[model samples]
Target: MYDFNSINDYLNTKIIGQTIIQYDNLTSTYAKDKNIFNTCPDGTVVLSENQSKCTVRFGNKWICREDKNIYLSIILKPIGKNLMISKFDVIGCSSVCEAVADTCNVECKIKWPNDVMINNNKISSVSCDFVGKSDDPSGVIISMVVNANMGTDEIDKINEEIKNSSTSLKIETGTDVHRELIIGHILNNVEKHYDEFMKQGTIISAVSSCIHNSAIVNKTISVMKRGKKTVRKLYAKSIDGEGRLVVADEKENEEILSPGETIIIYEGKA
Candidate 1:
């Protein structure tokens, strides 16, 4: 488990992760009710060494390994009307990607709907949703779980159970990194894009950053329509302004699929 003082000392963000809260174990980081949320200021980060509960974006069990991974949530209060949770999905990926690169010297890919992968094996999973009552001091919680330092056997087991194949910082780099440092880097990267979103009030830049680090973009990959196992081969052109995936075929005919309706798989070559 990472120390509170270490994470706090390492973080230097403006509006994200300004307050670091850690627990020895919890059901979930963002599991608090409306009353607790009302008291917590915006940018409060919640973390745990062992999570006994909760699911990711697709309702898949986020397998928590004791002291082997990083699972945390950053709270942002007073979400604006009609906020697109999709934008935050990619922004979370961007933050995780940048953090992985910063701490582990590893490049990552974005599997649609918030699975960050390295070599087609998942390194992180993200989720965002409005917490607290709509009428109260509610806000969006962007939660992520990074496979920071899990061992190979534990990583392998979760991979068989989860949709994406799994890998960890320890597995990929053959090294165990200080999880606290990675958390700090992720907070900083998140704040960078959060500032842009607040200032520009747009998803273009957020989508662009995710696209740059995209695993499926500009690649010939397998596309499985969400809710069914049926998969297709398509050329991923890019993610559009609305964060929808733009995929094309041999003759350049294109189909834009919403994140909820599409699942992408990266087959090694073509």
Candidate 2:
């Protein structure tokens, strides 16, 4: 469980979560994004020990068992003209990768757009919500899930379909990790890079960090589009300044993708 006092004491961010609303359980952290957007301060954070209906990109349910992972959502007001809200996904992913590495001593990688991978399997998922009427929103919600103390046995019990595709910090490090440390490190890293993004108005640092820490780029992979059956096989060339994936198909045609599933193929074989 996350100790509110310990987390608050350890948090080093300037404004990422000065005001936090924490619960032992909830339907979902971001589920209250609309309810609090009107009065919540810029860095208000909503955290829960468990979520009954946690969701991810494309409306998929995220597994949120108690005391097993990091589940929280942060509220932020849009800053700078060049600050694309989309870049926060990269920021979150990079921050998690760094935090996990720092705390667990196991290297993790980002899988384009947002998923964080450990040993070629997913260990974390990042999602964002902007509930305003227009493209420019008054507030933003950044939600994240990290598989922490959920041991290998627990992970093995997940839906058989994705059971083998996901992992946890305990599974990676063979030890029970302190959740508060992970959360504190993530908040600190997010604050550090977020300030840089707000100042530069671009994701240059985020793109570089993600590209360096990513495992999917430069690898032949399969891309599954949302609500569609068609899939594309491409080489993930890089993550552009705007956070779009730059990829090239077999025909040498270059294209950028958004909102798609990336499956890294094995050595260009299938």
Candidate 3:
């Protein structure tokens, strides 16, 4: 049994958690956070023990069991000079990767736009949604789902099909992990990285961080864009300033792809 109150109380004392709301159970923290985005504070964090209908980057269901994962959404009001959604995505994904590595001793990489991977298997997913425009916005709600503390048998029992493509901290480290600790680490890292982003006042720093820690950069990959018929196989060159995937084909023809679906073709390839 996890101590929700203790963790929530401790988290509220942190920088990113001015006001924290912890639901021992919920249908979807992301949906709920979006619903009350206007009323929440600038750095309000909504956490749940169980999310029955959690969603990831492509609106795919994030299979989460009761009291077994880190499911939360943070509502942030961008107060910086130039705040783009793409920059925020980079910050969020990088934050998760740093936090996971710091806590689990596993070096994870960003799989562009949002997914965090360890050994080519997804260990966490981050999704950012902005209600209004870049000039004038209500708030940016970032929903993150980190598969923490889930055992191999637990993951296999929940979604056997995706077990091969997905992984958790416990599965990688071969020990039970504390979800509360991981959440704390993530929130702290988000705040730290966000401050760095604010100081630079550009997405260049964010993009640089992603490129350095990316798992898909300089690798052969197949990209599947939304509503596109054909899949393109190209070498992932790097992440552009705007967070787009810059890829080139054999002919050396290059294309900058906006945030979409990308699959790494080879393992351990730079």
User: Which stretches of model 2 miss by more than 4 angstroms?
Assistant: 79-85, 260-270
> How much lDDT does each candidate structure score?
0.78, 0.79, 0.77
- The C-alpha TM-scores of every prediction are 0.86, 0.91, 0.87
Q: lDDT score, residue 249, model 1?
A: 84
Native-to-model Cα distance after best TM-score fit, residue 186 in candidate 3, in Å: 0.8
Q: Candidate 1's error at 213, in angstroms?
A: 1.5
Q: What TM-score should be assigned to candidate 3? A: 0.87
> Global CA lDDT of candidate 3, please?
0.77
What does candidate 1's lDDT look like per residue over 165-205, in tens digits?
66788988998889999998899888887777777776666
Please list all clashing residue pairs in model 3, or write none if there are none. none
RMSD of each: 3.2, 2.6, 3.1
Report the lDDT of model 3 for residue 14.
Answer: 42
- Candidates 1 and 2 compared by lDDT, better number: 2
How do the residues 1-270 of candidate 3 rate in per-residue lDDT, one tens digit apiece? 456665564352444766788787888887888888888777788988898788887677777877778888888776645656666788788878888888789889898888888888888888988866746777688889998878878778765557768888888999888777777777877777666655666566557768989988988887666766677779999988767788999999999876744433344332
Best by TM-score: 2
Local error of candidate 3 at residue 148 (angstroms): 0.8
